[model samples]
Target: MSKFKYIVVALLLSACTSDDTDTLIENSNTLTNYLQDRSVENGAVIACAGNTEDDTVSVEIFFYPEEDATNYRLYETSSTDVDSNDFLNYNRIFLNDAPVFNGYLRKFTGEFTTERWFIVSFEKDNEIKLSNPIRLKNESQPTLFANAISINQQLSQMPLFNWNVNSEMNNAIFFQVLSTINNDLISGTYTYENQFQYYDTSNVILNITNGTPPDLVLGDDYKMTIMDVSVDNWINEIFVSQFTVE
Candidate 1:
């Protein structure tokens, strides 16, 4: 071949090879997955602030860039930093389809009926991103059995409401007092803390303040719901009954 033709053929081969190299570089898109947000709501609790027993649970998990994950699974365990191998002995469930900012919000259908941590398993980039555990506990059930609606001389005088705290409950628990009419909290509500089940089988008062009104309408029917919540939002058990303020 002529010298000019040989040079032209060599240039074409180099251009082809350069194109192949560019394609290879462009295809190297690997990412590490992480959890940007994780939360649990409306899980089964005996007493929530305004929740009922039959309420279903809502879960949320999100990551940046939005499309990195292809699978989201839920695992139940007593431990932390668990992986796929833990899924073997752990109670597991899959939230099928690609992931989105709003995660799978559904009922608690796992085999665990007592207490367990619900951990999110985000599968992306051929790796897993596990979330901080959202707990679900039923062992220490609190009861509002002692709080009864009273009609007396002083409406401003709140009752030292009675309750039962479970042994499995956290040392610090949240207590909510609601004055309700027709099953709705009327006027305002109050919340208090019960530490370490210290006051189990006893009563306490939610002191009404400016945030919560001290006035109660006389001759009007009202009910008091004493609800206790665990520290991790895992337990809520409410006791409710009707009484008129005379």
Candidate 2:
């Protein structure tokens, strides 16, 4: 990543929503070739730029359209039944409802699988960037074991969230998980190493205490809505699940 110069998005437009801070000028002379190309090698998924060797990463970054009604920054888990989670980072990644980056290529290496999710943390209020998710196909992917499976039924408040972390993930800095209750969304970013089963005892608890948006209810049917996220052809995996409360 240090080898390439980032291309900052200098587009200017006008705000339309509460989350929108600056106007987006898409066709304007901001910066082009920000990102391009994608591939998988051994077990490492790579994102490429301008077809260069140095500019590559296992995860990818995306930006919201300059003008969108919904707050892209709001972390809303896409409907579980929809089979994909696109809005997982719109809110958690950016405070202003957009993205800003200047560079020719961003390269990364580390453990990657179908169950992994990655996100980039910038300065506060600066936009956040997430890698398109990937859920490795069991057949194509090596064995991924969950040390502890969590299932909470009956009366209770929000339960603690925990899962296995792949030990092979290399160069990973962070992990991002997004869950939903009906249409309500709850997102949490954690240290990448926490994904392994070794830390299941200290699982994460990302709740509505911070006041992100709509809260949960007594009973609701929810699902993780798994899908593979990618930029151009570079694809990362995300896993969804079916869970309920009673």
Candidate 3:
């Protein structure tokens, strides 16, 4: 009777242990499936110009879980290996306050001025699964002017030159304007403007009003180049299409 009782107790303990192991295995499978189904991609582009800052840009991480993910932790790295087991060294973002969802968006805000690349991974059940890597390139430089050209009509009151501002550029410090006649006549200095577009006819130029410089020499061809100058003097050059003055 005593032997039978001991045997029964051993079997009960064994059964309970087996049940616990099975529960762990099921949880692992659920987490794995969730990670496999999720995806990550590049987020929004944020730009900061000069010394000012804006928080409009956000870095987003998207995810969907199959089951109720408790104590979910996010890890990030710059490395490419998606199978690495150890990611504790990488930066982490906790999802404790995040709402349950078939999909969730994690947004990060701060200075992203310099170019950077990062990889993100999810963690649960002592398992680490990596998402697709994201690349964030910083576009803080002033944009190049486009389609600059010299208007025909040399004897005109003023040399007519036009250009398009770089679409990516914002908050320009000034514009550096350069003019050349017959591709040999170089201007002395640059011009400044807070605006994206500019036109030179008469009042802007001394010769246009006084008639001393004559705006331009009649019948002579001219080429003009315009550049957007930043505080750092990062100049984006735009050369005009050549045209002859009438």
Candidate 4:
């Protein structure tokens, strides 16, 4: 072969190899095989906050670790939900270190004005434990539930949370979250009452929940958030109140 032709062939071969390498790298990072390899289940508690001023959404994940799980990985997808057919498209985002209260918690912030979904998983003894799909949607508008909310901080240690729920929300599930001022989830659960007492279990429904009960710090501020969630995981209304521990 002529010297010029030999050089041209060498350049083409290099280009082909580079393209192949890029494809492999992208495939390796995808969640194509995660769903098939993991045992999917529920129990991850997700709280979403939408900033109307910034047109963004913030999601927080707080859950209890499976026995012997050393770490947890969080996956994200723009899909509305991660059904069996859509699970393979999820992309892992956060890899948490050590399965402690603080370690099992993660916060995700994005410029999302629409809804998104996520899945969290952990591995122990080669067995992967995956959480049921959690959804995050931006709700920038106020609702009736927001207008009818009130908190009684006179009994500071365990503030009484009260809200008015009309007949329309009779079947809706209510969620209460207690978090530190810094946004760390302390305790959260699904409840069925219009009035809930912090750190108390009177109104709790299915204690299959997340976060540790707060060890209130004197003079520190904490937040209590109440959400009315629809069956399909859409947050219909949300109200947040901050109170100082006496």
How many steric clashes does model 3 contain?
5
Please identify model 4 stretches exceeding 4 Å from their true place: 1-26, 30-32, 37-53, 57-71, 81-85, 93-104, 113-116, 139-148, 152-158, 165-172, 179-187, 206-222, 244-246
Looking at candidate 1, what is the lDDT of residue 101? 14
Compare candidates 1 and 4 on lDDT and give the better one.
4
Alpha-carbon local distance difference test for all models = 0.37, 0.29, 0.34, 0.54
Q: After best superposition, candidate 1 residue 124: deviation in angstroms? A: 26
What TM-score does prediction 3 earn?
0.30
Q: Which candidate wins on TM-score?
A: 4
How well does each candidate superpose onto the true structure, as a TM-score?
0.38, 0.32, 0.30, 0.57
Q: Sort by lDDT, best first.
A: 4, 1, 3, 2
lDDT of 1 by residue, 125-172 (tens): 554554433445433342223444332334233433344554434423
Question: Model 2, which residues run further than 4 Å from truth?
Answer: 1-149, 152-155, 171-174, 177-184, 193-215, 225-237
* Model 4 alpha-carbon miss at residue 203, Å: 1.8
Flag regions of model 1 displaced more than 4 Å: 1-115, 118-134, 139-171, 187-214
Error of 3 at 218 (Å): 1.6
Q: Which ten residues in a row have the lowest lDDT in candidate 4?
A: 4-13
lDDT of 2 by residue, 1-246 (tens): 211112222223222353321222232211111111211111111221111122222223332222221223212122223322322222222223222222211233332223333322222223323233333222233322222435443235344344443333322322333345452334433333334121132433321113342444457665432222223222223344556644
lDDT for each residue of candidate 4 in 1-246, tens digit (9 for 90 to 100): 121011111101122255545654666544444544344433333322233333335343434464466456777675564452244457777544332234433434444546567666666776565555555555433232353557676776767778766444422567676778766778766676667877778667744345456567878888777766544344556677787776
* Candidate 3: residue pairs that collide: 148-240, 153-245, 153-246, 154-245, 154-246
**Considering TM-score, which of the candidate structures 1 and 2 is the better prediction for this target?**
1
Supply the global lDDT for candidate 4: 0.54
